[model samples]
Target: MELRVEGLACRRGEAVVLRDVGFVLAPGEALILRGPNGAGKTTMLRALAGLTPPVAGTISAPQEAMAYGAHADGLKAQLTVAENLTFWAAAFGTSGIGPAVAAFDLGALLDRRTADLSAGQKRRASLARMVLTGRPIWLLDEPTVSLDAANVARFAAAVSTHLEAGGSALIATHIDLGLAETRVLDVTQFAARAAARREADPFAEAIE
Candidate 1:
């Protein structure tokens, strides 16, 4: 699997968040997107996931890709953990939820309501839904949020296994996720790119 973004830019109304951003991730490779608050990290992830359209440039990815946002998207507050997993499995065109349940250590929480689970448990359950997708590429935004050290380790292991199986990931996070050989991109660089473009603009130079 491969994901490539070339000269990508995104805007929310009048504000340009990500500008001229580009990168590539090959199979078994992972890239970590790092930026401070309001630096367009989430925007870039959403663009990559196709949840948000880029204002300029292109995102090239496989047909079967999945994305998990900062929120635990799969956990239904009103549903039991098992039911939540079941619902996601069916949605992802899978036949069984057993593997995802066991992989994420959600066995005990299966019968419990999603609302009853703690924050970390909810995050794990959400991750299980991503796993059930069986997609080759994963776009994760803050995947380790609310996870303890032990669960973080478990999450790292899961990601390692996924990469070993020819899967790829692009993770946007402020926390260290312990993924091996992960590349880091600082979105602040986009500002520099934009400035350079402005400096080279004939109209801007004339105005100055």
Candidate 2:
């Protein structure tokens, strides 16, 4: 499925930071979101993921097609690794967890509770859930935190395979994963103008 956005604008806590943002992500493609700190990369991803409403503009994607991963691992501390995978797979109506487990080599930790795992191990488990999602569009925000070089490569490999299977990913990260058919969207180009800030929030006093 193709994802398209046009004249997009978003806010971070009542302050409009990005405006007029647009991009098209076709199948078998990846787009890297690049911008300095506070440039609204996370906001953009959140809006696209339907976690937050955009201040303006539109995001076009099929229903049940977007899978979003934010900075939080989205894991249940009480659940074992395998159980966590099973739960997410059930939510997406997909039963295959083997590929997800193999993608990040989580076999050794499957029986262990998430709270007992080390930070890096936890991160790998969290990211591995993406494979089980079975969603064509992945919206990830800073997905590589706490990961070492080798694990980072594992993530890159997973993304490559996803794209090869005609999927698409939109990731916001500072580290470059060096994947194929990738493009960068510098959101600073869409930095909201002064007038846009006042429009994002209604209760705030107008700026003159």
Give the winner by TM-score: 2
Off by over 4 Å in 2: 194-208
* lDDT (Cα, tens digit) per residue for candidate 2, span 1-208: 9999998888888888888888999999999999898888999988888777888998889547988888899999999999999999998888778999999989999999999999999999999989988999999998899999999999999999999999999999899899999999988778887335546765454443
- Cα lDDT of candidate 2 equals 0.90
- For model 2 the TM-score comes to 0.91
My TM-score estimates for the predictions, one after another, are 0.89, 0.91
Model 1 lDDT per residue over 45-95, tens place: 777777777789887874457555555456679999999989888888998
Which parts of model 1 are misplaced by more than 4 Å? 192-208
lDDT leader:
2
Q: Local distance difference test, per candidate?
A: 0.80, 0.90
